[model samples]
Target: MKPTFIILSFFFFGMVLHLHAQSKVDSLTYYYGVVNQPKSNIQLAKAYNFFTKQKEQSIKRKDIEKAVFHLRLLASIEKKMGLLSDSEISSVEALRLLDGMTNPEMIKENRIGIYNHLGIVYRSLDNFSKALEFYSKSLELVEDEASKATLLNNIGNLYLDKNEYSRALVYFEEAYEKSPRLDLKMKARVLDNLGLAQAKLTLPGALSNLLEALSLRKTIDYIPGVITSYGHLSDYYLDKGDRETAQDYAQKALEQAKQLNNPQYLESTLATLVLLNGTPEVVQYKKLRDSLEKASVRAKDNFEYYRYQFSEQQRLFEESEFKRQKLFLTLILVILVFVAIYVVGRVKHNKEKLLKVYETETRISKKVHDEVANDMYQIMAKLQANNETEEVLDHLEAVYRKTRDISKEHSEIDVEGNFSETLMELLKGFNNDEVRVIVQSISKVDWRHFSNLQKTTIYRVLQELMVNMRKHSRASYVVLKFEQKGKSMAIQYTDNGVGTAIYKKGGLQNTENRMKSIKGSITFESNNDAGFKASIRI
Candidate 1:
């Protein structure tokens, strides 16, 4: 009876914890959806607790994937709350789960999202090198033109932080022009950033862009954006020594900042107001500024302490899991010596052949992605900007030449000659001097048995995988193995690069769709430390 009661008590405690987690999650949803301009640390803290509790439950159930989801959420929340280092560690841990994954499309999505978030966090921390790396990695995964434009804007912001105003202005312009009409807020932000960059260079269009951004913010009733625009206007006027206009905008910003009750903005507003004043209100504003600064520092310190505790606990847990896995793998390896010897010999033979082919293909791929692609992009930009018909024609002619060059390159591949050789050559392009690649079982497959459609699907799928790996993974080594089982064929690729987070339905999804179209299937696995892997059976 005592044992039964103890078990029942344990069950009841689990139920209570589950209920508490659900309550917190509900509160998070309400705050996210129902509250306007919610920026309280309390709100963010509640979100952090919710995910942390969920992560604990997931770990208890041995659901590493679910734990990853919770960790990613926690990371995003910590970032929003200004806990930079904690956010970075949480994102890193979330990515680590992908090491042994089989279907990483979901993880890839999570990874790219967290990568972008980490870039923002690093930028806020003024760590430009890390920020640029994360942004570049995120850029590699971005498919939509709008997403690319957004990343370009962020990268421009990085340049702005470095005071490279001219370089910043170029990226901001490209982002603004590439953004669609529907994304007016994004375009307005881009315009605002561009205006600031232009102002640094003393350019003509600075005022025009700022005013346009202000008008758009007003149209959308974006209060925070309005505050930001007002601040910019105040700074611009102040720089020009127009004290009256500067004070007016600063007063407006102060009023809005007070209404919003944001300590950081209020402090900024007060500082700006103090800069343009000798009035009695200046003394009062200064006092408020001092108090807000003190309170903000305390709050930030407390939050950092909390974040450290949570992250340290998670780190200990992950370290323990890693040790266990390492021990288990070591034990297993001890029982497979003969099989490992044969595998190593085969891999060495394939590596030699792959290296010779890789060099030739790398040259061709570089010519396409670097030379032709860049030339076409520059020409396209020029065509869009030039108003004169003759100039437009010249740029259009350049675009045509690059397009022809690409067509000629593709035509060099003989689909009828040998599909296996062609496929191997395609894989070869993904390798470089920094990374070693080995492919096996190419000769074992009878290419003549497969239909043209099957061969095409296989080629395209592998091509996407290799291209994605090259773009995002700073991999040191890669292995591709093929296996034939009855009428079905399986191809696997393993790479030692940064692992993926949950993937969205992007390139991998497109690959999956293509595979499904041909009654085939595909899977992916990755982790931050172990790298990325993909498998396809057709």
Candidate 2:
């Protein structure tokens, strides 16, 4: 064979591979965007197929990021479909791929996403501790208020499932406060959860929150949320000694559950109605609930079996990929040993220069957009005045100085050793003349047990929480307590401030993300009446 013909064949092979990979990625990205929408299972199934193909292509191309992305998507779909075991396997596989990559940022969002999804799966499987573990892991990685709010709510729900009503109530309140006003569905769910938790505790606002949640759900046409709300309302009214109202709401919930054909809600509503109305209908509802519960158990068993089979198939595919990668690596190593041994040496230098250029460009763009451009625009408005030219010049100078200060702040982070000491110092800084800051058991934690990275995460998390308290809580007293629990350390923070609604913000999100990166967990507790309390575990 001629050398030129051989080169042409290689080029064709490369082009074909590139096109195929691109196609798979495009398909996966498209499906990912719509996976959560109503009636999207069909599209998700198509996306799943593409994800499998992408995995194969990624393995062939030795692209760890792409492979992780594919596995993450697969896990998400599996979780959505109630295939908990399969979802867990896919998520673990994706996390494993991170070990081979230099930068995990490409799939950072997905990594935390899978953790939260796995938590949901575990929660569904009735593994409360495992669910909390995964949720905590996700909380550490959550960077946005919305995601944090969702995770907090999920954790609260897990506590609800565990029958820890007080713990659940804390998270529910935080989630309700932090969630955006625009997210009616989420807010309704939170309200419903709060109502349930409150009702369990026989709290004063249980009926109001539940009724409001039901109204909101009905307004938004969220049938599922409304159904759950009905059940909660029935429970609340029943507990309030109003059997008539309870029976009415229970019947309404049963009707909706029947319309939706949801066995879980059907069983719940039927059981509630059986207690409320002790007629001959009680016997029929009990029988129906028992039968449906049995069927639901069987269905779950079958789903698990199918998930097992799917996992076996995935295992086989991975085996094949491992073999293919081994052979591919051998071939590449042989070729590179001779032709590209020296070529690889300059790659790092070029990459570093490119990265520096990118960083500088990003900083300049952000400063211009966030500060310089807005300042200039204000200056332009002021320049419309006949005698405002000098004022405009002064404003421009101020903008420049502000921009320079911001740039410096952005570039430099106050990183210190001695995690406990640093944390104490930071907390002291927040302890103003009005705010009486109390530190408890700070010396009890064996900070030596944690690595610098873990310590740094702990410091930063406490700092963010305190900043939030100072900025929003307006509390006069703050308590910081540290406790060592077996191998892990826990920090409990409480504040007596005017606790307001918590929302997703960059600082809180970053704190969560930092904790997530270090596999630590943080929980926020607050209410309109009670002051704010936060618990951090590492």
Candidate 3:
């Protein structure tokens, strides 16, 4: 795996382990609570005795304190996993069990050192008032700086969620001021939250916070966080009226999400791409959307398994009315899953098919350019090189021109359906020593016609575009246009050369003839210092 991927996997694994630990704790809590309940007094009393009873006489000594320690650790894990329900109940039970222990065991407040986690659960559940209550209580009780920092973070989270940016900043700032190692989880959380709150208060999308967010997110490979920052950056640029920059950042978010294979990120990206539908940036958005669809299908399959499990659980409970309702809900979910899966797949396939067609055309065009008619052209060059009789020389010239004409006459269109690749190749060739070409506006075009002949004519016109620029214009950079103007197609080229009028010869006049054959007309604009420019209309 790449270093980046390994790091991401590590973070993801940490998160996954956190979840598993939380789930195990939830299961343990449920089992223990059932034992402790008022309805099962006999079992509750037995289990309580089993847990509380300690032995110093045996090798395999029973340790109730150790068991409760494990339970406390589990509750902290639940709080980190965003399992608000599990964290809340588990934390309460852990606190209750830790109470009444010998003072030497707790030794100040070590026995039930987990109120910060309770605060976290409340924060996630959107009970900020309760969350702050728990956090303050924990702060007063815990002497450990790390635990205090965790409480501060929990309080910060509550304020942040409530959109109280100034308050949130204060909490995080305080947490950072204390021990940075407050949690086994990454330390960047404080910096990240600090930056976000700062951005909200300062600007719609401030640079400093966003840059910090990007650096940290990239370091940890936090896919959600990275996408979020990129999204903010995109919006920032868009709001600043830098459309290209905004568009670039937005599209980059789409690309990064696609590579990560995160369907959730892609879903967010697609909404942006749809907004940029007709622009060059839309291409990136479309590409990611197509990939997201494939992933969403797999997600649906997983959801189906969950639905099945839920159904079994409902059936076992013998709650017929609830079961009926769950069954209906399950059926509806399955259909929506199928439809979503189908739509995503269909969009993906169409994009693939389009790309394939583009590739095939490119291959054919390359063959014609480098392989076909090559030997004949070489032979013509060799024949022209020889010193011979006038009649023989005339014969040679006639044969060469006739062969060229024949090749030109029977020319078929080379349409590499891929505009992106085609445009790249065209631009590469357009750059040479004799002609300096400035070719912008080369991407994400909606071609006027899909006909093979039309594509062929356009390719030749472009080839002629380069030829004209090289031989005549003495251009520094060639600005070529392949655009649709209303009902007609227009092409323009400008260059810096000595002012000159139309003296049609070699490739320039020949290109003019070719243009006429395609029913296209060429016009020239020139200046003494600015040199010459040409535009063609079809």
Candidate 4:
């Protein structure tokens, strides 16, 4: 009939009722009924095994609600069996599951239950500070009047155990006054506890409240409540120096304890009887207390073993998860790096192939100019010497000039030496009576900073642009401006010609490809109202 025993009894009763109300599955309902039954130690062990297996299976299936539910029940059973450490472990595990749940209402309700359960477990373990901590946490989350009343009563009992009678009375008073009146069983608990706190402080109304609680417990036929009320009444009378009445209540408590077949209740009742009866009862009480103390020591040892094993397992799982995530990220990074390298190598190979084609075209142009053009010149000279017609000689001479121009367009130049002078000479070649070509800032560029391939690309792109302008623009004046900006070079080409819509084709497309090969860029702008313009950046 201790406060701790009453609290635990109330907890199990509520838990069983809750499980019965919520469960729809037949198997689950059967197990709930089996666990709640007052049976032998063997039956209780079987119930524990069933819930443990259910919890494990639920976790494996990732059924969070079922897992948490089983864990909470497991904690309650463990606490009932006096395995305080195991109960603490079970309650904490349930709370861990609740942390990841997305349902707010479910999480809040389950958290309050688990916190309250942990408080009880800690209190049994004699960890008073930890008990208060969990109790405060549960109080913070509880909203319903019934839950508030229950928690307030439990807190009052805790303070009572600590001998803080005034503080216990305050909590008990508040619990009794809370809205939505408690049920007969809960009301009796609160009233009984309130009376005890008052009696401890020698306050008024203690006897009336105690009698009322006893009357309510008898009305409900709740044996545990009746036993607790009797025990409290005995203590109350004993405190007031009424040995005869105290002895009478203690005898009644002892009879109820024997009928209940609960060692804790029997042991407590025997201790009280020993206080009233003296000598012979004292030796019997001492033996029972020693046996209970030895059992408690074994339970404590078992708790320590379970706690160490649980902590070790948890640590190992977290370490394994950390390593797995790190390895996964490392694999992803390696794949990305290889992909980037392959793409870069492919682009480099294509650019080299393009540059090789350009070099081959230059060689073919030099061959055509040196061999076929020389043969045509010799043929024209022979025709003039043989006195052929003037028209024939003129036609042959035109063919020679076309061949020479083709050679000039694809001719190779010294891009690595005096690049600026070579570039200027190439631009000057486009000058004629029909058009005036002007160049600016050509000497300002640091030509040596550019690679051979980059210089070649620039030269070829410019040659193509000039050819396009000459053939299509019909411009009277052209200006090519070069400028250096930071580490890059820029070119602006403008022509005051009858402007036309810009199209990407023929020589213009070739120019774009050439610039792209060297990782440079070009843009063209033109309209009927404005002269043609191009901007190049490298």
Candidate 5:
């Protein structure tokens, strides 16, 4: 062949390979997004099929870069879907592909992504040491702070779980400070880890860190972290025999668990609730555990769903999640905005009714005190001057009867509206153009079920939450949900917001009181990069 023809041929081949690589990335992302939405196993099955073919074809083409990328994804997805050693084989294949790459920079980038994933797989397998080793390698080749910070955070968590508090803090703080960008989950994890470390140090920072992390989780809707943080706090208080504080935190954690639909968390929260001073915590624990066993079976029945739908289903799932999120927000706006208006109307109506009662009672009281009393006085004067004692006594009796009726009218209390309406309003307030919001609301109930005092208290709790989210959380997305199960209603809110840098607990006290007043409950979570989550159960 002529030299010119050879050069052009090579150029064309390289271009094809590059395009193919890009295509593979697009597919991975597309499929990954689909898995994020609500879907059936048919989807995952399709994704697994498509990607599997892509991986095989890439290997056959000797396109190592593309091959490894697909393999990494296949591994990760397999692990998450509960497929065992097959995922590990994919990771090994990814590393094998790397051996063929010659360019140093390209190799570094690929290796970083590969090793991070290796760490994920190993961590899932409980091979923490190997996970740590690969994560460290990924860190060494890192060009971006975000990548390094995430690795550091992961490493620190591994150490924390191993009970090496001091070592954990070193990496945790390093990641926290050096990380230019943070995620909600990462930040919450760091804060919670920091709290654990600080507690060991006996620093005032411990409580503050715990509280800050707890609060941030609430703002950003980091439900799991919120629940964990509360449990930690409850444990801290429990050890100290601060029954009141322990009970408060325990209750908060339980509320969050219910909101998240996490049976495992609820089980723990129920156990803690049993320990609270007033309730029969043991009874609640038994009941909760029995319920959890049943739910686990249900979850398991749906477990293989993701595996079977692995391909096209995954794509659809993500699209559905996006659409569902938008629809959720729209529904929230319609329901909560209307409910808020309803609450406001109810509040006004009650005030009006109360005022009418006050006015009528006042008018009657005044009539007895002023007009009827004067008549009695005149009768008494007549009795004294003209000897009419019997008439004076009769007038006094009539005046007393009128005064008693006035007292009865004024003593009655009527507060009849739906607390759900008020909660809906509070959630609706969190929705703004700066962020997207998804709401899943339970049925609205009659506020009349609650006392006047309870109504005011719960409203204030939700208000405190909205205020923190709007003011402190720079969240672009929020998820508000309400669900009713059996006798209880869970009002849950979550957001993806970078919230409080440290502990913020002043608002939580009010939140707790509001739930407690209505015999309801709350649980929440928050963090630096992710956002916050809180559940109010009534």
Candidate 6:
């Protein structure tokens, strides 16, 4: 029973490789043929070396399809050599490469192939549940009839290994029905499996199907399929109480297994021959089985070591990438902080420069008013007392008034006092009998929130506007309106004067600059025969 089942398992694996090989191209096809059917360990080792180098080159070039192609062939070779654990690792690596790939067709095809290969690998490892899981996954991805038939056959083989002959027959029958889509070699393999499953259940017609499968295999010269057919025929005859006929078939299986040069097939055929011809062959079968089992154990251990090394390298690479990203963020944050500091310092420097210039102008104006204007006032009084020319006295009076106006324009105001009252006084200074000045909503504004720089800017800007209006505007009435909107204070000034088209010069430009220095804004609007208007906001 053991020898017959072993032969069945061997051919099932052969069928799996044969189906998988149909899709290979060019260099991959050449390597697969060499590795899959190696005549010696040295030949397999050379093929392994070539595939490893090709896989590495493909990975370096970012060619995912080519890398996975090499991995699939390498897994087939590893499983053929009884390195079940290594085969499992290779198949999983190939699947990992397909993960998150944008190409859906490529992902589906490669994943189906790897999943089917993993099912075969796990079955060889005696992990029946894992084998079923992979087989089901492969089945889900298979869109083609040939691939579905192949998976069904593999599933049937799994049930056969568990001795569930009835359940195995169901899958085998379905696979056989699907065989028209498969090639002649695959059809022979599926028919052979179907016959074996039926023979295990002692079903009728099993003998005719087995003979037919053998005849099909012979037409194609498939040696592995012929050996499997002979082994199954032997088991069927023995089950029916025909010892002599079974022995004849066992001898034929042993001859073919030897010619094939596969140690596993030879050992299994010897086990069958021992059952028929006793004693002599028992020792050889046990010795060969023990040697193969030890080699399989060593292969599993080597695969575990390789897997551990791969995991460690992956861990180190992720840790390095995480640190690199962290460092980059830290650098960006530092640069942003430096930029904020530079901007604040530049604004502070400009504000200080503006304040210094204002103070200097105030000092010079005070000097001119105290000495030069007072001297002119005393000269005018002396000319009046001495009865000098009336024209000279009038000229002295005009000069004194001009000097006082300059002193008042540059004078610093007491912002700590009633600033609204100070602002109104400054605005009303332009009023006379010919021109009337109106100040509106002056007390409505809350002046406590304003800084000294802001107060000085507002005072200077309004003074410049009034001086410009009084000097050039031949207007009868002037209006100054103040209001608070949101977080800002706004002042609007208008006059029914002959408005000039030319603006943004002399005192008006100076007014614009002063408003800007304190982060405020002022706009002038005028046209011929239209009223002059100035709007200020801070």
In model 1, the Cα lDDT at residue 144 comes to 78
- Worst ten-residue run, lDDT, model 2? 406-415
lDDT of 4 by residue, 222-298 (tens): 77688899999999998999989999999998888777665667878988887677886676777787678766754
Instruction: Give lDDT: candidate 4, residue 469.
Output: 80
Which segments of candidate 5 are over 4 A away from where they belong? 1-30, 34-50, 60-62, 82-84, 183-185, 214-538
lDDT of 2: 0.75
> Which residue segments of model 2 deviate by more than 4 Å?
1-34, 40-70, 180-182, 254-538
In what order do the candidates fall by TM-score, top score first?
4, 6, 1, 2, 5, 3
The RMSD of every model to the true structure, in order and in angstroms, is 37.5, 38.2, 35.0, 18.0, 39.5, 19.3
Error of 3 at 355 (Å): 99
Per-residue CA lDDT of candidate 2, range 386-459, in tens?
46667667777677666654453233223455556766776787777879899999877776677655665566
lDDT of 4 at 354: 73
TM-score to true structure, per model = 0.46, 0.44, 0.33, 0.51, 0.39, 0.50
Q: Per-residue lDDT for 47-79 in model 6, tens only?
A: 787788878998999888889988888888788
Q: What is the lDDT of candidate 5?
A: 0.70
Q: What is the lDDT of residue 440 in candidate 2?
A: 96
| Candidate 5 residue lDDT tens string, 156-197 | 877866778788889888887863476666676677777777
Model 1, 188-215: lDDT tens digits are 8989988988888889999899989999
lDDT of each: 0.76, 0.75, 0.61, 0.84, 0.70, 0.84
Better of 2 and 6 by lDDT: 6
Model 1 regions more than 4 Å off: 1-28, 34-39, 58-69, 277-538
